[model samples]
Target: MVDPAPAQTKLANEQVELNIPIQPLGAAISRYGNATGRDVLYDANLASGRLSSEVRGVFAPDEALNKLLVGTGLKAELITGKTFVLVPVPASQQARQTSSPEHLRYYGLIQAGITDALCDAQGAHPGRYRFTAKLWIAPDGAVVRSRRIGSTGTPRSDHEIDAALRRVQLNKAPPPGFQQPVIILIVPQGPGVTRGCDRP
Candidate 1:
């Protein structure tokens, strides 16, 4: 189970502008907590023994922790804003690494099969419209189901989106309690069609 960090509510979506150097794990995390004014829970022995990489940019609290903890064979699980637990990396990895829905939109894995599914709906399926879809993934990482959040202005495209989602697979299951479904906007290739999507 994930440990709860204190002040959990307060730190939600907290971003930090960090410029820490490569140093002992404890020192880096200590400086991080001090700078961000957040509480961190970790074992002194473990934190003191490992070395952390220098993180020199803006990042979320958890993302920063992940960056700092890289190659340490450790991971930080925020139980609450003020509390974080250090767990073996294998524990988290063995459970199927989950991809946060918000992060999936930028994933380069948008396969053509999905858009190709629109072959019969209308020749307009390609280069005709952009489709945004909500993907609900199961614990095993299979996109259990999906719904069209918005349409490509055509029912045919909407159905085609659903067909395409069924073919999409996730690398791992959704995290324990992912709040929102993943949204992917698919732009059919054509004159104005682009392969990638804009940041949400």
Candidate 2:
């Protein structure tokens, strides 16, 4: 859980000009750090394959950061006036650490596999709904099983999401000590959501 009071107090009155484009979450965060002169620290896996909203106008750092993370199911916690870190929303937080290079690589592969599966079918395109999924992957990169924790507002959509996950197969095996039951949040497209998934 994050306490927004400190960030609110520190950045309530400071505004800066920003022109970050809708891009990968990690790059967008780097741009935010540069534009706001603040250090944003986070596990690289948290941003892997995630898209950020564009921040194109003058706004407080906190507000801009919030805008930048619109659909990614993440929030920033201020560590200091000059620093912040990204964390999963309270309900989605999992007991996993993804700091090692091998772990990060595995995470990226898993996410890419899931994204491809979700985007391949119109009924299950991730940009159309919101839900949380728990995945159990095999050593050879196949998604052995999956369980979704929320609905996509309809039984058909829920079935579609499950079907998509069933088709996921990563390019490599997970690293040692990588936790099981990976938790992933899927959300609809909005202000900062990544575009181009609809492209042919």
Candidate 3:
């Protein structure tokens, strides 16, 4: 008789808390997967040499993973209710998901604007903090919403990051009906040493 398929691990049913800090992309992912007993399939070539932001909060498996991969340019999708696959996103697709890059110069200009704003804020307030968020830009170069994926420990810092993102003025608005939310991570190079928002 044929062997029965292994029971799939359902992520939605799992509840777990995470306290992972900013580190190499591979290490963070591996650590989380191992701790939660979740099998995460990934390509070493793509995940290698990449850095990820920290994740510290109580959340379900899906929510925790979402926070972990915040600014890593990687996405996780649930397959078979238990399996998670990490995939790289292309620049072209980013536009389609968020909005058509007609006025915006794709991510180059968009990300630069965000980074500059974040750096400016970090310079003003010195501390160890990482803000991971998703921004929904309007068609008229307005920020419709800035949702913080995870806390930056202090409400004060979180407000600063939120304000910074809102302060960003895109040269061109995206195409209507496709205002795709973009991921932005504001973090420090070390402990209260260097602070900059990185796209990777």
Between prediction 2 and prediction 3, the one with superior lDDT is 2
- The residue-level lDDT of candidate 1 at 137 comes to 46
The better-scoring model by lDDT among 1 and 2 is: 2
lDDT of 2 by residue, 19-91 (tens): 9876777888877776776677888888785666657999988888987876465788988766788987654
Query: Which parts of model 3 have CA positions greater than 4 angstroms off?
Result: 1-11, 96-200
lDDT of 2 at 118: 84
**Local accuracy by lDDT, each model:** 0.58, 0.72, 0.63
Give candidate 1 misplaced runs (Cα > 4 Å): 1-11, 91-200
- Compute each candidate's TM-score over C-alphas: 0.40, 0.49, 0.45
lDDT of 1 by residue, 109-142 (tens): 4343344444433333445566576654443455
Q: After superposition, how far is residue 27 of candidate 1 from its true place, in Å?
A: 0.6
Error of 3 at 36 (Å): 1.3
What would the per-residue lDDT of candidate 3 be over residues 31-141, giving only the tens digit for each residue? 777657676777887677555555677778777787676545678877756667888766776546555454345554566667677667753242366666676554445
User: Whose lDDT is higher: candidate 1's or candidate 3's?
Assistant: 3
Instruction: Please give the TM-score that candidate 1 achieves against the real structure.
Output: 0.40
RMSD of each: 15.9, 16.7, 13.9
Number of the top lDDT candidate: 2
